[model samples]
Target: MVESLASPWRHDFPQLLENPQLHYLDSAATALKPSAVVEASRRVLSEDYGPIHRGLYPAAERATDAYEAARSTLHRFLGGREDDCLVFTRSATESLNLLAEGWLQSVLVPGDEVWVTTLEHHANYLPWKRVCERVGATLRVVPLNTDQTIDATQFDDLHPRVKLVAITAVSNVLGVALPVSEIAARAHAVGALVVVDAAQAIGHQRIDLATWGCDAVVASAHKMSGPTGIGVLLARRSVLECTEPLLVGGGMVDLATAEQPVWAALPSKLEAGSPNLVGAVAMAAAADYLSDAGIDRVESHVAALTHSASEALAQLRGVSVLALDAPERDHGIVSFNLDGVHPHDVGQIAGELGVAVRAGHHCCQPLMQALGVDATVRASFALYNDDTDVDALVSAVENVIDVFGVR
Candidate 1:
């Protein structure tokens, strides 16, 4: 057995300890929530629950304060200068759709091009695809290198006609960390807006929208140990100012007349109905928890775990680890296929052994096609996971091979 690396802050996540028999390695899909975030969300439902921006009662006032304060907390957490630039949505997928329907569909014309990498989740790919189809715009794909990373050399494909570049900061399947800053610069040079899908990177890396040089970035709260119903979309004030509201309702309009309707300001314009106030509070708590623990330390710990796990898994026979050539660069996600065993079978056997791993296309069917496979078993790490989790996963895979009678 390999020596296990203990997580220093594992105590913060009660779910990890409460379920002693389960080894969770599906953090790429969603992370287990911390106690602090759970408590914060509970407080909102039990004590300070009220509709925000609707009433003048004490509950409403307090709820409004908490809701707006949560926005400010995220603004600071993401190194955003303006709170109004951050729009809260139901999930990262919704945020991307908001950008697609509200911004891209409105601005894109026939013959315009939107460039995206093959490493995108469906959240990033499908929205652009639909928008391009609607507007008669062309969707261009950036190919990947042999190592499963975006080929930076092929960025010359980004021409002057490219209106936007939608890319993921980290691949959900391959775990390859793309050069966002470089891509942003290249996209900007061509006068194209850059939108980063940071769903997988937010919890594992430090995000500074101001310095990243991207026009917009989106992430799901659940992916970062927060609640499920809330997500963040951070954009420049200028960009938010230009985006048309995707959903229009009572809260989003300043004045609605029979003749002409005026929309509300930046964030409110995008947030239509009653917002997810409790989810916002819970996500703020999560942001605070992560910030207090130090993002750099969390990243370092997960990176070490990823490297060790990758090294261990590669040694096993009939195991094909994707991007094994550069395990150190992966953002805490390791995906592989067992020879002569279907990914579904491997996942099922691993699940029966008390290991929870995600298997299949992982919402990236195009990437699966590129990799010449229909699916893969993905073991993703988070701050709450330790070396024992990795050991459990590897042992479970060995059990799968043994049960299948694979050589």
Candidate 2:
């Protein structure tokens, strides 16, 4: 058994302690919430429930204050400027769609090109694809290297007609970090705007919009131990000022005449209706918890777990660990396949043994096709996981091989 790199802060999460036998390795899908986040959410739902930005009552005022405060917290957490507009959405998918419909559709024209990578999740890929189709623009792809990371050298293939580049900071399936800063610099040289899908990277790495030099970034709250139904889109102030709102309704309009309606300011104009106030508060608490724990320490801890688990799994016969021969650059995700066993069956068997993992294409069918596999079993680590969880996962896979007789 590998020595325990037990998380000192694991006790902060009540869900992990609630079921001692359960080994949750599916954090890439959604993280288990910490007690602070849960308590914060409960407090909001129980005491401060009210419609925001519409009333002068104490409860309404408190709700609006808390909601906007949450935005401020996230902005600082992400290293965003105070003037930047952070729009709240249901998920990263909605954030990308908003940019597609609100920003890209207005700017793109026939014969223009957009570049995306093979490592993108469907949320990042499909939006650009649809936008390009609608505007008669061409969607180009940056192929992946043999190790499954983005081939940065191929970025020169970006034609002068390329108007935008949409890419992920990390691959959801392979966990390899891409050179977003380099890509952004290259794309900017060609006068193309860069949009980053940071859903998988936000929880594992420190995000600084200024350092990346990208025009926009989108990430989800749930993946970082926050509440569901809340996500953030941080864009440059200039970009938000010019990009139109995807959804227009109450709370987003400043003035509405018979023929013309003036939209509200930066953040509110993008936020179409009553926002997920409770979710925002909980997500803020989550961000505070991560910050207090030190994101660098959390990242280092998870990376160690990933390396240990990947090395162990690679030693097992009939288990093909993806990117095992390549230099280690994964965050915390380790995807693999058991010979002759389908990924879903592998996941089901692991679940029966109290080991939770994710199976299937992981919302990246294009990536799956590029990998030449229909699906993969992914065991993703988080701040709450330890060596015991890795042992449990390896034991479960051993049981799977025994049951299937895969030599």
Candidate 3:
């Protein structure tokens, strides 16, 4: 067991509705912002706002510096090498689209296969599917085992014809962490590039892009205690250079003429318009706050919450917790279903009792279908959650089941 580490900033959050007994467990859907992140955005949007990268005004230069510094912070956080380039997009969905529309089209040809997992979020799946649709390629789905982890037996099926292997670092619904480095290595053996969706991975675990050696990865800032409308696409410089730009706009161009247009270098080439400078600055502040709190400690705290919630949920009659197979799958999320009770009902009941939880298909309908359910009630944790919050959740769920007369 990891030692409990204190998060001084926990109390600084606005406490949502400010009920003394409020239990917030919907973090996987979207994280609650720390006061710093909220205030950072407020300060910029109100007091120091400016357009970045295209203006010569004092505020614009300041905004540009702050925004690019956010990029630098992200690079350092991911431990990206000098050869890595970071592309900012609207969300993880857009980031994946940017890659599929750009990088995959440039490299993939007829008969090439891009391997994806059945456990992917639609953001990761559909873009690759579109690429295959456009490029006359195939999208091969890697199967998951009965235990819900990626079936390693399928490794033999990968071959040189496989141009890319896209997988999620953690299943948003299942909360299971895939063997990303190992999977990336296997894909490379067949000369395939790997793209990891780390939208759920960053705050829970450390990500070293250089060591992972995957061709690319995507993450959303909103899911990691930052502002929404900003996501990152991390790519090796060589891989990025070969990717065609999907959106051609002002910031991404070096020289433009009627006859032909030249795109800017990597990183800038991918960011087409006036970027979300305020959001990026706020995201960096959030990242800095988390770093000060220490990721290992934050992870340990979340693990304790997950293990407790999983165990508590499993003890309930007719309730099944997802992602209990791998001990390493211990992240902040706890997804499960109550027998004879609708997931939406569970969410409603929890909400009525001052407990916030998520219900419905959590953007992974295939995974939900595979689990033999229409949807689930997900209780995701963050550093702010404590034993009191956990107890409230368990009690609220029990009450919900009782009210529904579910065994």
- Listed in order, each prediction's TM-score against the native is 0.97, 0.97, 0.95
- Per-residue lDDT of 77-166 in model 3, one digit per residue for the tens? 876888888888888888899889888888889999999987899898899999898999999877778777885456667899999999
Off by over 4 Å in 3: 1-9, 16-19, 151-153
For model 3, what is the C-alpha lDDT against the true structure?
A: 0.83
Candidate 1 per-residue lDDT over residues 1-407, each given as its tens digit: 66668898888888877888878899999999999998998899999999999989999999999999999999889878653388999999999998998888888999999999999999999999999998898999887787777755667767888999999988998777888888888889999999999999888889887788888899999999998989999888787878898888889998888567999887899999999999999999999999999999999888888888888889888899999885326688999999999999999999999899999999999999998999999999998888899899989988988888878
TM value for model 2: 0.97
- Our model 2 lands, by Cα RMSD against the true structure, at 1.2
What are the lDDT figures for the candidates, one per model?
0.89, 0.89, 0.83
Q: What ranking emerges by lDDT with the best candidate at the front?
A: 2, 1, 3
Question: Which pairs clash in model 3?
Answer: none
Q: Count of backbone clashes for each model?
A: 0, 0, 0
